[model samples]
Target: MILQVDELGKMHSGKQEQVLFAHVSATIEEPTRICMIGASGQGKSTLLRIIGFMDREDQGQVLLQGKDRSKWVPREWRKQASYVAQQPVMLAGTIEDNLRVVSTLHQSVFDEKLAKRLMERAGLTEMAWSKPASDLSGGEKQRLALVRSMLLRPAILLLDEVTSSLDMHSKQLIEMMLMDWHEEEETTLIWVTHDMDQARQCSSRLWFLAEGTILEDVSTVDFFEEPRTQPGRKFLGIQSVRERKWSGEGINYV
Candidate 1:
């Protein structure tokens, strides 16, 4: 398996402690698109953070490439399982500096040809590498952030609402670019998205979080066609289909 989570449990730490979620288990045997969706406070971002090694899971063991997370070096783990935050922060320098940081930190040669191709695919060809990275628009920053993460050549990409703040056009661009990137690199994508359409369009599998855990894990088509759980149906705005009974006098709604 590429990745595996065994009984992951998390807690909300503060003045009063509470269980955020528990009994969450999953395995990614190969490279494919997986979308995590749920209402607010479902710990979607936290789950991604935990998987990326940015946050610790209160209870459970995570195995990346069949080795426990605790066994791997922090930077080495992060190199394979990289995260792109919702808010893309620019380094204090030009655009070139931002992209080069990844290679610099990894002590690897910067691939200029790859960077140029990624920038073009992200529709950032007009951008100047010499210009200050801070001056770019919000959408531009988000796209650049993705490119920076891609430069790491991670096996699994953990995206935490990376395209949530962009315009429809920009969001579509990001979605398209991500799909193409996945195909090009055969990267396993664990993307968190609230937009149902985007999830349906971009992901091959759906990881539906609800009631403090992953309530549903199935193919995108099967989940949308008929969710097995009430929360999943409600999230999809689908009423209980099987509950409808045919009455002798008239059709029963329930």
Candidate 2:
């Protein structure tokens, strides 16, 4: 296994203590695409944060490549399992500066040629690369952030709705870029997306999370065709209704 979570537990302690999740366990084998879907506040992002080592778990262990994540330095852990948030922050600089800064990290070297090619694939014009990154559009920033993550050459990529606010063109381009990046046999993807169609498009496995636990983990085909659990069925049913309504086939409520 590439990564393993052993009874991971996280809780909030404040004026309002909240138990985000308890006794949650999952395994991520190498070189596979897994999509995590759940309603908002169901701990999808929380789980990703824990996995990325951005947040601490109240309890449980995170193992990477058969060793505890604690055994690896934070920088080394991040270099192997990188994360890109929904709202990516762009530093005060040109696109070139932003791309070049990744070289200072412990991961992959800065490849100007590869960076330019990635920009081209992401539908960014040469002029845009010279413009200040802070002035770029939301979609453009997302594309650049994706490129930055890719430059790290992480073994596992953790994305949390990275393209949610993007236009269709930008969304499709990002999806394509991610797919191309995962063409290698050593890279794994753990994507957290609310878009079911996009989830199906990019992931081979679907992990259904509800009430702070993974209710089911199955192949994407099985998830849609034959959901095993009631929660999974209900989730699929709701999405099906939404899709139908979107197609202008509203239910005839007599």
Candidate 3:
């Protein structure tokens, strides 16, 4: 397994203690494309934060490459994985500058050629290389965030609704980029999206979260065909056959 979470639990202390997830466990093997789907505020983002190490779990252990992460340095883990937030957080400079600032890898390790290639692949070759990040379109900014994270060539990538606000063309571009990465590079991808159609396209597996728990973890084929849980069925209602067909593979609801 490339990544594993065992009996993970987290609770936020606020006006009321909010248990984000409890006793949650999952494994991500190489080349796994797992899509996390659920209603808004269902803790999909929170789960990503926990796996990305941005937030600590109240209990349980996270293992990466067979080693317990609690015993290892977080900075070391970060080098092996990266998270792209829902919103792009760019710096006050050129696109390259923004990447440089958020880059955790060495400058010598940076592959300028590969970066440019990824930018081109993401459909931003025109304005991505030299344009100031502040002036880029929303889709361009999202693509930049993706390319910046790819600079690390991380073994695992956590994406939270990276294409939520994009136009259909932009969304298709992002989808194709991710599909290429999964097929060509075998990158372990974990994405959270409210778009069921997008989720079905990019993920072979589906993980449904609701009320701070993973109600279903199954193949996307099975989840859509015959959802085993109430929440899973409810979430599926957000997309129709026409939209699910965008995956290019008809849903095998059986």
Candidate 4:
């Protein structure tokens, strides 16, 4: 398995600890695309954070390449399973500085060519690399953050609504760019998104979170066709056959 999430659990710590979720398990046999879908407060982003090593789980473990997360250094694990937050916290300094920060910290040569290519793809070709990253708008910052993460070329890319801030055109560009990147690099993409079109565009498998656990883990076609649980069916409102057909393959990211 490339990555394994074995019976993971977390709690909201306070006067009374509340169980967020438990016995959550899944395994990635290879580099492929999977989308996690659910309503808000399902611990979707929390799970991604755990997998990326940004947060520790209260119970169970996350494994990458047969090694448990506890056995690996945090920095190294992050390099392999990079997380891109919905609201990105930009690095201090120029746009170029943000792009090259990962390589600098990792003591690896920065891929300037790839950075430039990604910036262009993100519709940031006109943006000055010398400009302060903090000066960028929210949408621009979101795209910049994504470009920075792509520079790491991690095996598993953890994305939490990375395109939520972008305009429709920019969103489409990113979707296309990421699909191309996934194809070229064979990277495993685990994205948490409410945009069903976005989820459908980039995934083969869909994991539905409900009732404090994974209610369904199945192929996109199967889940959309007939969700096993009532919550799953409720999550997906009534869509016609033609609309559901797009969920299968008709809607291309490109």
Candidate 5:
């Protein structure tokens, strides 16, 4: 398996303990594209954080490439498996300067040609590269963060609503770029998205999370056509309602 979460659990110690997830076990093997869908305040981001080593689980083990996560140095492990947060922060410099930071951190030669190609693919103009990163819009920052994360060519990428801020055109561009990259590499993708259409397009499997646990894990085909759990079915039903509303089909039922 590329990555494995074995009975992993996380909890917060507030006035009343909040268990984010408990006994959550999942395996990501090969270059499978897995889309995680859940309501807000669910543990989708929390689970991604644990897998990326950004947060520690209360119990259970995380294994990467058949070895315990503890065996690998934190930095090296993170380089191989990276996480892109929902709200990304940019450095206080030009776009090119921000992209160049990857080379400095990785001790690898910067690939300017590849950077230029990626920028074009991401719909970033040359002029945008010279502008101060702080001046960019939310969508621009989101794309810049994606570019930075992908530059490392991580083996496993954990994306938490990475395209949430972009317009439809930019969103499509980034999705195309990412799908092309996935097709050309042996990287595994675990994307958390509320956009069901995007999930259907990019993922081969769907994982439904609710109430501090994974309610469903199935192939994308089965997820939409044959959801076994009530939560999975309900989520799909909601998506259907939204689609209908968007298509001007009046909804008579709540």
Candidate 6:
């Protein structure tokens, strides 16, 4: 397994006691693309942070490459994976500087040519190399963020709504780049998204989350074909199918 999350749970310190999932378990294999779908504020971003090592889980273990992550240094684990957020967080520098920071982390000799190629692949070739990152448009910023992540060539990628703010063309470009990366490098992708259509198009598996727990975990086809949980069916707008009384191992629609 490329990544394993066992019995993951998180709770904030408050009287209301908001719990973000309990007993969440998942394993990602090489070249696997998983789309986590749910309503807004369902802790999808929180789950990504936990997996990415940006935030620690209140309980449970995250294993990368079959080694318990807690046993490893946090910086070492971060070197093995890259987390890209919805908004691009660019530093006060040029695009070249941004790419260099990540490339130098793993490579002894940073190759500017390779960096330029990757940026071009991400649709950032038009004067992006020399321009200030702060001056780029929203789509440009998103692509630049992806290019920065790609420079690290991480085995696992944690994406939190990376495409939520892009236009149709930019979104398609990102989709193509992700598919190419998955096929070429066997990278494992875990993305949190609200767009079911986009999720169906890009991911091989789906994990549906709601109220701090996973409602269903299944193949993307099964999710759309016969959602096993009422929350899953309702989220997918398959009320008619639920009324037909199809039985499955997961939760039943009421």
Best by TM-score: 1
Q: Give the TM-score of candidate 2.
A: 0.89
Q: Per-residue lDDT of 1-254 in model 1, one digit per residue for the tens?
A: 88999999998875257888999999999998999999988899999999999999999989999999768999989989998998888999999999999999899999999999989878889999999999998888988999999999999999989897788877888889899889989999999999889889999999999998999999999998989998998888776645433223334546
lDDT score for residue 185 of model 3:
76
Give the per-residue Cα lDDT of candidate 1 at 34: 100
Q: In terms of lDDT, which candidate is stronger, 5 or 6?
A: 5
**Number of the predicted model whose lDDT against the real structure is largest:** 1
Model 4 weakest 10-residue run by lDDT: 237-246
How well does candidate 3 match the true structure in TM-score terms? 0.87
Segments in model 4 whose C-alpha atoms lie over 4 Å from true places: 239-254
Which structure is stronger by TM-score: 1 or 2? 1
Scored by lDDT, model 4 comes in at: 0.90
- Give stretches of model 1 more than 4 Å off: 243-254
lDDT of 3: 0.80
Q: What is the C-alpha RMSD, rounded to one decimal, of candidate 1? A: 2.4
The 10 consecutive residues of candidate 6 with the worst lDDT sum are 241-250
Ranking 4 against 5 by lDDT, winner: 4
lDDT values for all models: 0.91, 0.83, 0.80, 0.90, 0.85, 0.80
Which lDDT tens digits does candidate 6 get at residues 66-152? Answer: 999758787667766788988879978987877787756655466778778777776677765668889888777877888788767
Clashes of 2: 0
RMSD of each: 2.4, 4.8, 6.4, 6.8, 5.0, 4.3
What does the lDDT come to for candidate 1? 0.91
Q: What is the lDDT of candidate 5?
A: 0.85
**TM-score per candidate, chains pooled:** 0.94, 0.89, 0.87, 0.92, 0.90, 0.90
**Candidate 3 residue runs with Cα over 4 Å from true position:** 13-15, 102-107, 238-254
TM-score, candidate 1, is: 0.94
